[model samples]
Target: MSTASDYLSRLISFDSVSRNSNEPVSDCVAAWLQELNFEVERTTYVDPRGVRKCNLLARRDPIAAQEQTLASGTGGLAYFCHTDTVTADRWTGPGGNPFHAVFENGRIYGRGACDMKGSLAAMLDAAQSISLADQMRPLWIVCTADEEVGFEGAQYLVDHSAAFRDLASLDPVSIIGEPTRLSVIHAHKGIVGMRIRSQGKAAHSSTDMGINANVAMVPMLQTLLEIDEQCRTDETLRNDAFDPPTLTWNFGVSDEMKTVNIVPDHCTAWASMRTMPGVDGREIVERVRRRAEELGLSFDLYSGGDPMHTDRDAPFVKELCELAEPYIGANEPHAVCYATDGCVLGELNRRIVCGPGGIAQAHTSDEFIEIEQLENGVRFYQDAIRHWCC
Candidate 1:
């Protein structure tokens, strides 16, 4: 039997970064499930970059697939995890390779250790430890690709895959294994990523003939800042459940001219907004566009994920909290500030975010998961399986 730690080490070695193909890691997971007598369906799709990404959906019993009817009572349980991790170029461990898992000081250090191949390993171990014959409902494990880059793999599964269609039809109680330090998460902010481009005529800096796109962006940026301030001060957008209790915006990236002597003809700025549950992300985008237009600049809203909030009093959530409380100590269903693939999956079924490690450790130079936490995560998943599937 492979322990969670053993499975984590193998998963970490895959280097399944978001910009790269997740086929290798997905293949490993599929094979492992197959070995457990699961009927695996590999859904392959070509990403926008023409890279082939694979999403794996596995069920323990093959006959379950033919059962067209959804489970009526105590429906199936599905564990969802993303196979891709963000890029890590500055690893601080001994091997200096982000893909190489290193155990040190009671922690497993790797790129995806915290957010969240750790949870993936725990789910695998817990599933394998349980006897399928005792399960009252089908157990499904889904591994999606490109979660780090706008959840493209999840989007593909929801839009195109037949396996996901069947699972959605069943209305399974779902768990999205994002690292929450084993606490239950019922609410989280959404993200809206936008790219605004300012175009102007290029000329020598010494001459006033150039429109200077960089200069043109100043008023537009100020407009965004004002809008952000309004969002921060608005009580309507506040959700007291979340920390800070208001929408947050950041202008993180900019593309502009390289040389000092040339007046920039084109300038692009990338910004993201984190919105509360009831806030309208599309309205926010339109507001930004309106502001840009008023400032005489061209703008485009590119990508975003919706805010997610499962009722804390939901039966499944309460059951999960009860099941996880023993291992995690007073498991409270709280809200997080960051986004998850749950933003998409929550639309399909009743879902919660619960797993090992902390968001603080995710995507850091020294990403790691505490050994004890990893073990407890396995226990949590096992308890969930017993509660929901048995």
Candidate 2:
């Protein structure tokens, strides 16, 4: 079997930036899996704007396209990992070109090296080694696209004809291979994208006849801060596994009035809220809207994902933790503040997040994955597949 570290080096060299199409990387992975005797099914996805992307679903033998058989008593398993990475910005030092693979100081440096191409490579290489082995439940590996955008790739695959109605393991135990530093992730926060518009009367600043939209933003920001604080102190809602257990609100993009002399008629701000499980994101949004209406400021709060979690003591969770102890050392499973493809995949299966690399290294310059982490990841996944599938 090819070592995951060597496979990762090649994945780092592919340059599958989120802005750039992932067809090349997807094609490369499809070719490798097929060579290992996997039957590949490619799903073509078109964005609302007509942009097309690809999702590859590869499976092993003794299963037909219309087969619905799953290993009885012990179900099937799905391995998911995204091939796309965020655009590498111009940075000084080793990150000048994130596409160029660099292996030094016991780490691998590249654009998608840690944010997840490394995990993808490790999963792919490991899957290839065991694709055709006789097993109880079939193994399914999904290679998705547009994860950097909105998880379009994974979402499409789950709802696609092949995943829901046709595949053998209809509701497999889904594992998202993100950079979790080899931690077993049973729960994480969910995101809600929102936009609020503050309205005002337009007039010359000198005339003092205009309602300043900029002035209106102050109270909105304050209210958001208050909400954030509430999220921090709410005891019943907090999960100690997470450092802070509550909804986190952060500003996104905003549209402001330009000239200081003119009081603009509209001031728009985009914000997002990441909520913990059991928090009613939609209700919070309605409350924000009510507050805006009471203040007489035109505002809109659109609700997003409330947050999702899996019982830490679930059988699958227990089995996975047991499988990883030998490979990853005393495993400490926990929840995180970030979101992953697990949110969407949860709809189809019992899902968990586990992989190599620290979350701190993701989305940063000089992003990398430790060589030891990759090796451990390889072993953990191998064991999981054997324990569950074989």
Candidate 3:
């Protein structure tokens, strides 16, 4: 009997931060789906910090023949959402707790209210409204963990889940519930995070016997700047759909000796790149690697995800656009600069990023979602489910 707002309030109450366990939220979602007669599957994995995170896959298959259907290549539609939110230490809302969902001024204020939990609530309500007898195919509701950190939960599902394996064979269609303001998103930039390190001999600063690793890092930093400049000015890498239409880099963190008097033997710079689709991330890394070699420094490519782009002309894209036009009006499909689990899910199936709320409201100090947008999202998902599932 819980409404979408009630469900969202419950979801936001859980502190499913990227660094913490998402099991609490996952458990709540599973219980809700069970009430709706869904056969839920929970996948648990231990993170690097040994916290147990979970991914929930709930399906509405009354006849219990989804496995065969999926194996035969007619996979059902899936609504994908991430359960984790970014950690917030600077909350300015009334309750002074990011986990406390506050309803005020026609908006819901809380952590994850706009970033994702809003869409999760809408999806749950939409599924609840669907009649099992009207369903022509299986319907899946997926909640993943660690999406704010990386696509860890999605990756785990892809690697280990039998349901995912079956769906991959069928090439299922997925709707990723990211905060896209109800606009259809068919493309997004990828991410590459790396660390550049320089090593040298350590000694007293006053003595001429030591080499400063910080000094050695200067040329490498310059190289990174030059590479960034090239990416910015290069027309070939530009995609007009994106706002900036060029690769962007952030050299955000640097580590060196604590004391000014001691000669630093090692310096490390942590940086990341946002790459356009069709551009080779490896080539970009190699460009930096070659420069590091020229400067006689060692580097490590830590982690990365490929860019995602579904063709706007795809059948599913057209159908979704048509289905959403009446509710959200006619908004052309677009690209975003931010990354999502769609970057990973797109590899297995046709994926579109569309949901309630705006990216501007996400992860902010006073994160909130307009109540109207939340209600519209619920209606849109209900109609979408009817269109795709029934």
Model 3 CA lDDT for position 145: 91
Candidate 2, residues 310-348, lDDT tens digits: the string is 888888888888877776677766888888876666565
Best by TM-score: 1
Segments of candidate 1 deviating more than 4 angstroms: 62-74, 252-255
Model 3 spans > 4 angstroms off = 64-72, 200-204, 207-211, 256-259, 294-296
Cα RMSD, model 1: 2.2
List, residue by residue over 15-56, the lDDT tens digit for candidate 3.
998999999889889999999988888889998899999998
Work out the TM-score per prediction.
0.94, 0.85, 0.93
lDDT of candidate 1 vs native? 0.84
Clashing residue pairs, backbone N/CA/C < 3 A, model 3: none
lDDT of 2: 0.74
lDDT for predicted candidate 3 compared with the true structure = 0.83
Q: What is candidate 1's lDDT per residue for 64-153, written digit by digit as tens?
A: 433532335345788999999998987786568889899999999999999899999999999998886667677899999988998788
User: How would you order the candidates by lDDT, starting with the best?
Assistant: 1, 3, 2
